[model samples]
Structure formats: structure tokens, C-alpha cells
Target: MLESLLWGAVAAAPLVLGAVLAGIRAWPDRLLGIVLGFGAGALIASIAFELWQDGLEQGGPVPLAIGVALGAAVYFTADRLVERWAKRAGGGAAAGVPLALGALLDGIPEQLVLGFGLADGAGVSVALVVAIFVSNLPESIGSSSDLLDGGVKRPAVLGIWSAVAALCALSTVAGWALADVASASIRTGLNGFAAGALLVMMVDSMIPEAQKRAKDLAGVATVFGFALAAGLSALGG
Candidate 1:
């Protein structure tokens, strides 16, 4: 139980930090390009060094390819649907629903994959947790900023973020439980799929937004942010 809670905290750390960072000044738009560049690099590295290799070792090329293709397709379709919905709703509750539901849906699968990795071995789990944490930090910050920009009160923003963190905890715990019953091949495939999905998400969404906000000190801050993430990944490794 203590171990699970500790892992949960590790998972939530990035989101908490991101929320705090979002309260800072907006970054410049140009910096978004740079951040996206680094993010793309990181995603590639994660896929090559961790997800792809691990999946191959555990399942083989066929399963890894299938998982990657499926994951990519799902996210691509979901992204299109969400964009359409957001366009139709145009800032009303309907607009918010897609974003909130997307975020909520994201948490479950991601945490579940991480939990399975962690259950397999400390090294695999730690590497993935670190990667996800690094990725989530920027995402959380962006989410908070979007909410605030959309006129959400600070208290409400904090509450929503906190609730999401709690959901992450639940997802991680549930994943750990599932790890006990699931086959290693299935777990590996799922993790690979998650890696692919995250790559698409970072490329198409997070990095683009971060780049849009990059300018002046924001550019420098974005570089610092990537450095921090890289450092954390190294330390965790």
C-alpha cells in the first residue's frame, strides 16, 4: 500500500508542478516551436529506447506494430471528433465536455500502462513513470492556463486539477491490480500503444500550444523546461 501510494505521488508530481507553473506569465509564441522540437525529440527517444524496444522484447514485431497502429488510429479519430465537437460547441458546456472527457479518458489508460510496467520491474516502471511525469508537467500547466484563460476561477481550476490527480492515483492502483492477472505480452503491447498515442498527442497538441506561447523569456523557460524534464528522466533512470 505504501509503495503504491508512493508511486501515485510520483505520478502526480508533474501535474501539481504544472498547475503551479501555469500561474506564471504566458510564454512567447516562438518558443512554442522550440518546445515542440524538444518534445518531438523526447517522444522519439521514448519510443525508440523504451516502448518499441521493450515491446519487441516482450511480444515481438507483429504485436508491437499492431499496437502502435491501433493506438495511433484511436487517437487520430478521437482528435478529429473532439475538434469537431469543440468547433460546434464554441466555448459552451459542450466544448468543455470533450476536453474534460478527453483528459479523464487519457488518465486511465496512461496510468494503467505505467502500473503494468512498474509491476513488471522497477527499472521499466521507473523509466516510464519519469517519462510520463515529464510529459504531464507541461500538459498540466497548459490545461490550467487554458482553463484560466477560458474564465475559470482559480479555485475551480485547482479543484479540477486536484481531482484529476486523484483519478491518476486510482488508475495507477487499478493498473497494478490488473498487472497481476494480465499476460506480459498484453501489458507490453498496451504500453507500446500508449507510447505511440503520447507521441501523437505531444506532437499534434502539447508542443504546438507550447510553441504558440513561446516568446521572450518564455522561449528560455521552455528550454529550461525540457532540460528539467531530461534531468528528471536521467535521475529516475
Candidate 2:
């Protein structure tokens, strides 16, 4: 459990770091959007190389399919509620919503995969660890920056992202505990759930926002991010 917690913290470390960096200076919206796109790209690699492949191996087709559908449904419903709340709150509250969603959606499963690997005695990959760092950094950075821009207090923004990072880190321990008892299908289902939620966030939140802000450069930034993170995954293999 201690090991799991430690490793989980390791994976989530970038979130806090990113938030801290976000406070160092006021960043331009266009640059922040490009960074978000870059993080989304890294997340894409994580979904493909880590979540989907592991899920396919563990649960086969049926459970993965069911998990994906369920995950999508849950996220969509939650997102609607979030949007309504954001509208009610007024101001730029909605701007940071998707980024927060992305962090929540993928953070759990991302660390859980690590926890499961630890439990299974699978050797941790240094490159994959770096890949997680790559994926998480810009996410928190963009989210923090967005919140600051949206009229959110800096202290509150710090608190919010910090809480998220803590939860994600704890999820590693949850996965570690679950691994001993969870069947292969269950593991796959969880992975599928993460993948499904992440994909949706990418489409509705990350990609569109990046495109809206960064315009033509969003695609280039995304591809650059993909190549970098994917290259890291390749090194792991």
C-alpha cells in the first residue's frame, strides 16, 4: 500500500508542479491552448498504448465494450450537470470545466494501471513513467491557467487542482487493492471506462478548445506532442 501510494504520487506529481508553474506568470490564451493540445496528444498515446491495449488483453471484447458505453454515459451525464452549474455560477467558470473533467476522467485509470502493474509484479517502465508526466503536466497547467483567467482566485485554483491530484494519487492505491481481487475482465472494464471518458473529453473539450484558440497551430502542437509521447512509449517497449 505504501508503495502504491508512493508511485501514485510520483505519477501525479506533475499536476501540482504544473499548477505551481501556472502561477509563476500570466500566460497567453493562445499559448495555453497549444499546451492543452500538446497534453491532449500525450493523453492520446496513453489511451492507445496503455489503456486500450491492456484492456483488450484483459477483458476481450464484451466487457470492454460494456465498460466503454457505461463510462461514456456517466461522463456525458456528469458533464451536462457540470455545464449547468457552470452557467449558473456565471463568469468564466465554464472555461476550466473541460480541463478539470479531463484531469478527473483519465487521472484515476492512469495511475490505476501503474498500481495494477505493481501488484502483478510487472516491472515499471521508466519511459512510461515519463509518458505519464508528459501527459499530466500541461493538463494541470492549462486548467490552472484557465481558472485564473476565469476570475477564480489563485488560492482556490491551487486548492482545486491539488484536491484533484490527491484523488488521482489515491486511486493508485485503490487499484493496487483491487488488483488482488479483481478479475481480468474487471481490469479491462476499468481501462475501457477510462479510455471512453478520455476520448469524449478530447473531442468535446480539449480538441475544440485548442482549435478555437490556437487555430492552425493546434494540430501541429498536437502532433508534436503525440510524437514525443509515443516515442517515449516506444522506448518502453
- lDDT per residue as tens, model 1, 1-237: 445556766877676666666666664445434544444444455556656766788788777777777777777788788778767767632222223333444555566766775676654445556676655655566566676666666677667777877887777777777888877677666756766676667656655565565534444555565565556556555
Whole-model lDDT, model 2: 0.84
Candidate 2: tens digits of C-alpha lDDT, residues 202-231:
888888888888888999999989999989
Best by lDDT: 2
Off by over 4 Å in 1: 24-40, 91-107, 117-131, 215-237
RMSD (Å) of each candidate, 1 decimal:
4.2, 1.3
Per-model CA lDDT versus the true structure? 0.61, 0.84
Provide backbone clash counts, one per model. 11, 0
- Provide the lowest-lDDT 10-residue window in model 2: 91-100
Candidate 2 shows a clash count of 0
TM-score of each: 0.73, 0.95
- Candidate 1, residue 104: the lDDT equals 48
